[model samples]
Target: MNTDTIVAVATPAGKGGVAVVRLSGSEALAVAMGHLTASRLQPRKATFCRFTDTAGQLVDEVLATWFPAPHSYTGEEMVEISCHGSPYVQQEVVAELIASGARLAEPGEFTLRAFANGKLDLSQAEAVADLIDSATPAQHRLAVSQLRGGYANELKRLRQQLLDLTSLLELELDFSQEDVEFADRCTMLDTVAQLQSRVQSLLGSFSTGNALKQGVPVAILGRANAGKSTLLNALLGDDRAIVSPIAGTTRDTIEETMTIDGITFRFIDTAGLSQSDDELEALGFARSIKAAQQATILLFVRSVTIPFNAYATDDIAYFTDQCDMSSKHLFIVHNKCDLPHESNPPGHIVSAKEGLGIDSLKASMVAAMRKDASANDGVLLTNLRHRSALQRVQEALLHVAEGLGQQMPTDLVAVDLRDAIYHLGTITGDVTNDELLGNIFSRFCVGK
Candidate 1:
């Protein structure tokens, strides 16, 4: 436990209506009181007071609130000073507190203390950072869910089951000399199978969770002069991409992001796919193919003004051969609907220049994502560290299942079981180390 008091400016640096400087630790109150006009403070009450330096000169008039130990954010005695938002006022007040014996806080020290004091688990502590950094509603909801213990509760249940099985297996090992079995091998195998299934399900959610956390990648692909860049500008409600009549105007990918119905989509407008004699144009085509391969969704744009038989329909054949579409959501979009066409294909028809049918296209994209999200359970695994730990748990469970199936010695099976438990424990901080904690908390902003 940290005994020395730590202080920091909690609010973002700049002028606002007010600024908050936070202090936490055993000596927080004493350090704060030393620089205030009031001799004592009422716990949890905001008292207007005059802040002064050690030389007894007034620095600022402030509203100070005190939170007693074990009930505050860090479960330690805490003091919050609400001062004028002037940069000089904020800096002077902090300097006064430091002169009175409070040290400057490191990044994430406040939340670190909260975790150290048992106010939050390891996963929830990470969620605090996520919630702070979330830009979209989907990301915010995922972070809030994890912070509320919805995800942690699920892991606790799994860890409890593993503990129960491990205890039984260890007991059986102890009774081996007597040639007696305490745990039925068949029952143990069944439990291990169930655990593996749950672990695998969590692992499966990582892709969707990560996509939601980081915007989903959507690649807009088509032949040259197909209005792919025009469609990109229309979807973004801005002229983000260059609109040119010349073919191959976009020699590389132009990326932009937009939030539709709370989900963020990263739209990549790639160079039009075509066999170009120019080396630069060919390099752009290569990048386009790479973008298509990585995209979760692909929009194949076609110009209605262009004849279907033009280029002998070789571009479509080339795209089909170059990209794997089996796992991706494919949308055929016919651009330039305002122009005359011989036939209307069976797909979305739109005029990118006039912003026609853009809303419908956005709706379709959202619908596809909703369908994908509906396939998973409510719990999502967004953190890469959690995903890695769960993956190890799955691997260990697999080994346990294999050993049990092969009728391996009880001691060997128990070893695998322990490995799975240890990995699972790492997620919720049932097992943790100094290095892991440092890596996690250091990412947080100071005074959080």
Candidate 2:
């Protein structure tokens, strides 16, 4: 545990109704009391008081609460002061605390301390940042679940199972010459297979879980003046993108996010792809093609004004072929449906100008996401770090399985099993280094 006390303004900067300044560590209570005019500070109880500077000049009236070591946020002595939310007042209070020996906290230092004090595991510590940064309801729910031991609990169980197997394999090596097999070879193979399946399943859910945590990317593609921007404006119910009758008006991709049915979609309206002589427009066209390929869903917009034959060009064919529609959602949309049209085709027809079929388009997008998202499953693996670790676990188990199939030496099998166990321990933080902890916690806000 760190011996030096830390202080920072807990709330956002600027004037508001109230601001909270927090201190944590060995001398947190003493530092807070230095500026507070109160006879006694009680633990977990709010006490009204006056805050004063070193010269004995009153700074502001405030409420102070104290939490002693082993019970506070950092599992150390802590103090929180709430006062009028003026930038000047907050700064003055923090400055006074610094003079009283509390140092300003580094970004994420508070939460880092919490992790060191055994208040949370590495995965749970990362979730604290996720919960703070969540922009949508779905994200909030996912983060909350993670913070409340969502995948961490599962990871612990899985790690223990692997540890047990490694122990048995290592024990078998002790009686190698005697040929006394404590662990049955056939049953051991079966148990390893089951654990491998579970690890693979979690790895498979990474794409969908990550998309939910970070908004899903949807690329909008079409030719010049094909109503791509118009469709974007209509879907967002605002003039978010520039729409014009002129061709090649949108020379670059314009991205925006909107939540529908609690699912957030990042719509990237790329420059219209067509034969363009302009250098900038041509570069943008290349970007459009790349964006379409990477998107989770491709929204292909076509103005009814353009004949169907126009979409049959080589560029369109190349784009469609490059996109794996089987794995990705593809929405073929016919825009400007307000005009008279022919018989209904398989694709959705919409009038961006009149907002026709926009609702159904949104509904389709949500339905596609819902089909992919695992809602009620035990835990979704959202973090790429966890996914990579699981992948390593899978690779090591594969080696172990191969060795078992070949009837390899017991020591060789034990080596692979220990490798698998080491990788699994990294996920729940049973095995970690300072560098990994620093990288994860550095993204958090100061005074977390």
Candidate 3:
């Protein structure tokens, strides 16, 4: 446990109903009580008192709550002072606490202390930051599930299973001269295969999990004068992109974000895909192709004025070939539906200029996002770091299974099993380093 006390204003830096200054560590209570006029401070009870400086000048009429060691946020004595939301009052209270021997906390240092004191594991600690930053209902659900030991609990169970098997293999090594097998070869292979299957399942969820955690990328693709920019503006409900009847008016891609049914969709309106001799337009056209390739969802916008056969245009065909269209969720959208054209177009019809069919298009996008979403009742692996570690675990498990099949030495098999266990432990902080902790916690807000 840390010996020195730390203090910081735990609320946002602005005027509000109230602001909180928190203190933790051995001297937290002492520093907090030094400024309070009340003679008795009860644990877990909020005491209303007047806060004052060392010179007996009143600062604010605040409520202070005390928490004794081992039952508080940082597993140490803690105090929280709630005062009127004034920046001056907050600063003065902090200054008074510092004068009484509390130092300001560093970014994420409070949560780091909590982790160090065994209040939370590494995964749960990361979840603390996620819960704070969650912008939507889905994100909040995921963070809460993780904080409740979602993937961390599952990984712990898996690691324990591997550890048990490895111990059996180790025992066989000790009695190698007798040629006795402590672990059944068939049973060990079966266990490894099961572990591998679970790891792969989690690895597959990375795509959906990451997209939900961050924002989904949707790329708008079509030729010039296809109302691509108009469609973008309509989807955003604002004049985000310039619309012009002139061909190739959009020389570059315009990116904007909008929330659809609690999911953030980043829409990128790219330049039209046509053979252009102009240098900058050519560069933008190349960028458009790149965006189409990278987008999670592709909106192949087309105008009704353009014949339905335009779907087979050389540029469209080239783009389809360049991007493995099968990998991404592709949606064909016919814009300018109000105008006269062919009897049938190969997609959802919409008039971006008239705001028709926009709601249906949004619904389709949300459906695409939820197509593979199973009941997400437990923790999903949203962090790339967690996915990478699970991938390594999967590889190590595969090695163990293969070694067991080939009747490799028990000690060699044990090495692979241990490697798999170590990788699993990394997710739950059973095996971690200072650098990884620093990188994870640095993204947190200063007061957290």
Candidate 4:
């Protein structure tokens, strides 16, 4: 636990209607009271007071609140001073506290103390940073879910089951000479299989979780003069891309982001995919293919003015050969429906010029991404660190299952079980190191 008192400007930089200066640790209240005109402060109650420096010069009128030890954010005595949001005023108040002996806090130090004091676990602490950085509703919901302990609780339950299994195996090892087995081998194998399945399910959720946490990438791809840029603008509800009737107008990918129904989608309007004689146009073609390969969803736009049956099959085949479309969610968007076209066009028909069928297209995109995420109680794994740890746990469980199937020695099986438990423990800080803690918390902003 940290022993020294720390102080910082808790709110964001720059002037607002109000600014907060936070102080924590053993000397927090004392350091704050030293400059306050108030004779005394009641715990957890806000008291309006006048603040002054050592020379007894007034600084600002502030509302001071004291949070006594063990009930505060860091589980230590804490003080929060709310004052007018003047940068100079915030600086003067902090300087006064520092002069009175409270050091400026390091990045994430306050939350680090909270973790050390058992106010929150490792995952929850990480969630605090996520919540602060959340830009969209989906990200906010995910961070909130983890912060509320649902994710932690589930992990803890799995770890407890593994610990129980390990205990039984350890017991069997101790009684090896007596030729007794505390655990039924058949039941043990089933348990290990079940655990591995659950871990694998979580590992599978990483792709969707990461996409939602970050915006989902959608690449708009088609041949030259196919109205791909028009579709991009329609989806974004803005003229984000330059629309031109000339061939190869867009020579590079133009990327933009828009939030639809609380989900953020990064739309990439790529240069048309076609055989180009010019070097720069050829380079654009290459980039367009790369964008298509990277995107989670692909919008293959085609103008309705063109004969659909004449070029549809050949174009689709060419694009399929150029990029891997097996993993991507593809939509053959027949754009310019407002123009004269055939009665039965293949795939989705839309008029980007008139804004027709764009809403349905967006709905389909969201549906495709949300389909896999709607399962497993919606407990998506968004952290790469957690995914990596769960992967190791999965591997360890696999080794345990293999050893039991091969009738390996009890001691060897026990070792693998312990390995699985350790990795699982790392996720929630049941097992952690100073280096890991420092790395995770350092990313947090100071005063948090």
Candidate 5:
């Protein structure tokens, strides 16, 4: 939006088949024309030319593409030079671009300008990052839907609906003394109910989406020789954790990440939970307790051989006492499925050594991951900030429902509805602060 020329290397920094150096602004064509050693060129057309340095020395032979103003990205003239993959060529081309007229762009500066020029909205701009960082098929689908305007469409419709309800409430406030009705009570109730349901549904996707982006953290916890570490290595299909007949062989927590059915899981293998007189073992017990508190799911492991914790009352007292029932999901895993199934955990039975029943364990993990959000939906809320803001909006809408059902003053109901609408708008940056805007835009790499 500043109208000054911007330049950046659009391609990755390292060696590639070819590298792209990009420029955007009113002077973009002029800068490109001079560097490409051409007198003139057509817009949106690719031109083969020689790129030169300021001293008029030939740097590289490359292809340049120009896109003219108002119809291009950033709503301005844009040009890109495809040069040799050599780092020297890329650097020289970018240097000449800055020397000729363009300024080096900040991280995400190109996309920020495009947003300012109305080339893309806030949500669409955000999708650019999501698309870049996407690792799985589901993540790609969400980003593409958002980039294609699916989320923006839904949010816009919800905002307009809130506006209509508020307009009626305002009208009723104006006619308060005469006892004339502008907003029908029944109609308002139906609208509020419908909106509350939609917002809450959308809110549901955050937990699943975020967990998909960051591997779901599950902790394996149990007392000595309960086969917790053995289960971990078997689940990961590797000897990631040490196994032995000796009790307390694992003195520290070990972690490994893997993707199952496109969902990443971080398995934290904890030390044997035992009241040991050994100083090091005692320290390990402390670390396991810390991890247990932070874990998303607690795998209370037991062996078919041991069948139960030997020191359960003394060693596994944390689960029985300060366990967060709601925050942490619990999964009881019975290890040593290689032998005849024995009486053990009430939930799941598996052998980490043979990978027996591991598929069921993964299924159970994914089901627990979906507890807060449905991954089957088309649109999802992945950002935590948006979730928190939307939660506030949801609470305000509840207040609105309370006010309307109690036959409260029209002005009071209008205020609550307006507050809810404002919070919802904040999620999409329709109502946002400069600091938050800075944080959001700062994540982008230049030349988007």
Candidate 6:
């Protein structure tokens, strides 16, 4: 396709070590040559140049590099101008390119063009955004692996197997009138089972993948003056929430996502749980209960010296009387071991003020979530879009298999199989719509 040339400030704006202006499309080299004064240009080779306007106005001295089509990042003729990192210089360069017929690129338009030109598959393209937005080291590592063909290779192999099975079945259909047996029924059944198992394994990964992508929600719950806020600051290694000796200090939930040993955790500091008849305080307590329910893990903070409360000791009665039993994913934490206060006897002893037991608590939390991650290992259904698409494909495949087992008309089975194939193709852009593409790529940052 003869796409129009596009240009943009490829490097981050403002003063830096170096600024890069990228041009891609049919006229990339022409635009570069017109603006940049280079003695001779060689593919993949850097050249010293003096950029100038058409009116022979001096622009700036810079480094120019060109990459030919089918060998470039976007699989198009590409040029990169490395100039001094100054906003004025960058703006001047972009203006010169725009004046020379290259249009300013939109957010992710470069990558979008790459996809349209068949330079990258849909999954690898998505991984580009994931790589940029990664919050933790582990996340960045995983995204990099996926982008470099870890996940893509796996999906490709599975899809190829499914395609081969479908091809064999379709071939068998050709001699249906002659009562010929081209493919064995046992083989077909075994293949279906294998694909189903693979899909299920991927489905199991959604929980951990989601948790890894979006940090796990953990709510801290305890009575007023129970050192809940203090505990939060200790765990975060910073004072995020205001701490005071007064009761009902925290009015609303304070949320922060922090990583401890590569695992990301979203700690929610709920209003101190207490017996308050005040309508607003009652509402805060109610919100705490709600958090306890929504949370995957609950940190029930209390003083180490004080005896257990009715809610903590009478576990069955607490479940029966106040909070939902299913909602309580309980972890009893004894905060303020160094202070003189009433609290449950040191279960997992801690003094948030002294930063004691913080490491053990973190280790315990990691162990619990690690158990969750390991239980459903290797089968990571990370993308919700992929999961839903696969689910629909699974249903269509089941319909085809059921129709085959019933010995229905071959046309019916064939139609179901084609529909399933189409559904599967959507994962890699074979069957996709503009709206879906737009909604996805729009979330990407402009410089991407």
Expressed as tens digits, the lDDT of each residue in 198-276 for candidate 4 is: 8887787777778888988898988888999989999989988899999999999999998887788889999886666
- Per-residue lDDT over 1-448 for candidate 3, one digit per residue giving the tens place of the 0 to 100 score: 3569999999999898899999998999989888999997899999999999999999999999999988988788999999999999999999999999999888888888888888998888999999999998767767877788557777777878888898889888889999998778998888888888788777877766777778778899988889999999999999999998898989888999888898888899999966668888899999999988878788988888877775535656767778876547878888898999787645789999999999999999988877634533344788878888899999898889999999998888888889998888788888888898889889887778
User: If scored against the real structure, what TM-score would every candidate get?
Assistant: 0.92, 0.88, 0.92, 0.93, 0.86, 0.85
Off-target runs (Cα >4 Å) in candidate 5 are: 38-40, 173-179, 275-297, 307-330, 340-347, 363-378
For candidate 6, lDDT tens digit of each residue in 317-365?
3323555444234678877778775645545778999999999998988
Q: Which 10-residue span in candidate 3 carries the lowest summed lDDT?
A: 370-379
- Which order, best to worst by TM-score? 4, 3, 1, 2, 5, 6
The superposed Cα distance between candidate 3 and the true structure at residue 267, in angstroms, equals: 0.4
Q: How many steric overlaps are in each model, in order?
A: 0, 0, 0, 0, 2, 3
Model 3 TM-score on a 0 to 1 scale? 0.92
Q: What overall lDDT goes with each candidate model?
A: 0.89, 0.86, 0.86, 0.89, 0.80, 0.77
RMSD in Å for all candidates: 2.5, 3.0, 2.3, 2.2, 3.4, 3.7
Which candidate's TM-score is highest? 4
User: Alpha-carbon error at 246 in model 2, in Å?
Assistant: 6.1
Minimal lDDT window, size 10, model 6: 315-324
Residue-level lDDT of model 1, residues 1-448, one tens digit each, is: 5668999999998888899999998999999988899878999999999999999899899999999999999999999999999999999999889988999999999999999889998999999999999999989988998999467788988999999998998888778888778877898899898988888777877776787889988999999899999999999999999989898999999899999999999999999966669899999988898888878788889898887677525766677677776546878888899998878657788999999999999999998877766554678788999999999999999999999999999899899999999999888887999899999999999889
Candidate 4 has a TM-score of 0.93
Off by over 4 Å in 4: 277-279, 307-328
